[model samples]
Target chain A: DAGVTQSPTHLIKTRGQQVTLRCSPKSGHDTVSWYQQALGQGPQFIFQYYEEEERQRGNFPDRFSGHQFPNYSSELNVNALLLGDSALYLCASSLRTGDLMGTEAFFGQGTRLTVV
Target chain B: DQQVKQNSPSLSVQEGRISILNCDYTNSMFDYFLWYKKYPAEGPTFLISISSIKDKNEDGRFTVFLNKSAKHLSLHIVPSQPGDSAVYFCAASVAGKSTFGDGTTLTVKP
Candidate 1:
C-alpha cells in the first residue's frame, strides 16, 4: 500500500556541485516521470521513462538527465547545478506507457533541493 | 510564456458555498485537462480530470468542465468544506508531456 517514495527528503548543495535524487514508484506501476517545481510556479515536466527507456522528455537541458531501472525505480541527475536549480523535485508514476489520458499518475512527496 | 495560466493567485469563500477555479491554456494540442490539489511542502495530488471528448465530468462534489472553444477549463467544488482549502493547480497534457498552471490558493472560511 506504500505509494511512490523518494530519498533525502531535503538536500542542500553548493553551485557547480552535482546531485542525484532517487525514486521508487508505487507497486503495480511501470512508468516514472520527473518534474521540477520552482517557487510560486507549477511543476515543469523534466522527463518520463518507461521500461527502463526514456520514452518522453520536456524542454530541460541535457544537463538534466534521468534513468529508469528494471524495477521501475528512477533517478534524476542534474549536473553543474545553479541556484535556479533549487526547487522541489517530484516523481510521479503511471500504470501505462502513454500519457495522462492513458493512465492516472500518482506523485511522491518530492525532494526539496536547495543550491547555496 | 506560460502556456497554462491560472490568473488568480488566491481566493476565499465561505464554507458550504461554491468555489470556482478557472484555468486557461494557449496550446490547442492539449486535449486532457486535470486539476491537482496541493498542500504546503507536498507534491500535488490529482483531484479530477476531464478529457477533450467530454465537456464535463462530475464525481461527488467535485466537477471539471472543459471548453475547447475558449481554450479554457474550470474546476467547481460545491458545498465547499473547510478541508477543501488548498492550492489548486490546473494541468494540461498531450502525449506524455504535460504543462501546469501557477496555481490558485483557496480558503474556505468557517
Candidate 2:
C-alpha cells in the first residue's frame, strides 16, 4: 500500500511571505497531523485534522493553520513566515479507532522549509 | 517545557554490544510511549512501543521498557549493527497528540 506522501521535498520562502505545504495521508488512514522539527531538535506537534475539522492543536501561533480535504489530504499554511519557521515539516497519518488515536502512526519524508 | 527528554544527545557502542537509549517524561497523563529511528533526510520510522499497563514490550531484537512511576522509558537494541547508526527519538502520547524528545544519535562501530 502507498504510504503517506508530502509535496515539495524542499522549499525556500521569504519573510512576511506565505507558504502552503501539502500532504496525502496513507491509504486507509483518516487522521492527519503536522509536526515541525527544528535543527538539532525533535519533532514538535503543530496540529491534527480529523473529519475535515481541526481536532487538536499544540502550542503554535495563530499564523499556523491547516485544512483536511474530503479525500484525507491535508495542507499546512504558514502566514508571515519568520526565519525561525525554517524547519522540516512532517506529516503523519493514522487511523482513528473509536475515540482513541491510532496506536501507531506512519510518517512522510517531510518537507524542508527554509525561510530567508 | 519539554514533556519528553532524551538527555543523551549521542551514544556509541561496539558491534554486537547492547545499546540502551533512555528517555524521561514530565507528563504523568501520558500512557503510551514509542521509539522511532531516523536516518538523515528521512522521517522517523516507528520502532517499538509500550503502553502504561505494561512495563515491557519486545519485538525481535528490539525491546522497550516503561517505568510509569518514574515517568521514564528506554529502548534496548541487542547485538547492535553498524546499520543501526541513526537518530532515535522517544515519544509519549495522550489523547491524539504526541510529544517527542530531542533524539539520541546512536553510532554502532564495527
Candidate 3:
C-alpha cells in the first residue's frame, strides 16, 4: 500500500508572507496529524484532524491552522511566516478504529519549509 | 516545558558494539512510548515502540526497554553498524496527543 505522501518537497517563503503545505494520508488511514521539527529539535505536535474536523491541537499560535478534507488529505497554512518557521513540516496518519495499540502512526516524507 | 527528554545530544560507538540511547519522560500518564530514526533532510521513521505494561520488547538486533517506575526508556542496538547512525527521537502518548524528546544523534563507527 502507498504510504503517507507530502507535496512541494521543498519551499521558500518570505517573511510576512503566507504558505500552504499539503499532505495525503496513507491508504486505509483516516486520522491526520501535523508536526513541526526545527533544527536539532524533535517533532512538536501542531494539531490533529479526525472526521474532517480538528480533534486536537498543540500550543502553536493562531497563525498556524489546518484543514482536513473528506478524502483524508490535509493542508497546513502558516501566515506571516518568520525566519524561525524554517523547519520540516511533517504529516502523520493512523487508523483510529482499532485498539489504542493498533492505532500506530506512520509519517510522511515531510515538506521542508524555509522562511527567508 | 518539554515533557520528553533525551539528555545526550550525541553518541558514538564502534561497529559490532552495543549502542544504547536513553530517554526520560516527565508525564506520568503516558501509556505508550515509541522511538523513531531520522535521516538528514528526511522525516522521522518509526523504529520501535513499547507499552507501559511491558518492560522490554525485542525485534531482531534492536530492543526497547521501558521502566515505567523510573519514567525512562532505552533503545539498544546490538552489533551496531554504520547504516544505523541517525537521529533518534523518543515520543510518549498519554491521550490524543504525543510528546517528543529533543532527539539523540547516534553514530556507529565502522
lDDT winner: 2
Best of the candidates, DockQ: 2
Chain B TM-score per candidate, please: 0.98, 0.98, 0.97
lDDT of 1 by residue, B73-94 (tens): 9999999999999999999988
Which regions of candidate 2 are displaced past 4 Å? none
Instruction: Name the candidate that leads on TM-score.
Output: 2
Clashing pairs in 2: none
Could you estimate the TM-score for every candidate? Answer: 0.97, 0.98, 0.95
lDDT pick, better of 1 and 3: 1
Residue A55 displacement in candidate 2 (angstroms): 0.7
* Over 4 Å off, model 3: A98-102
| lDDT per residue (tens digit) for residues B51-83 in model 2 | 888999999889999988888999999989999
Indicate the worst ten consecutive residues by lDDT in candidate 2 chain A. Answer: A97-106
Total clashing pairs in model 2: 0
How much does candidate 3 score in TM-score?
0.95
| DockQ by candidate, in order | 0.73, 0.80, 0.63
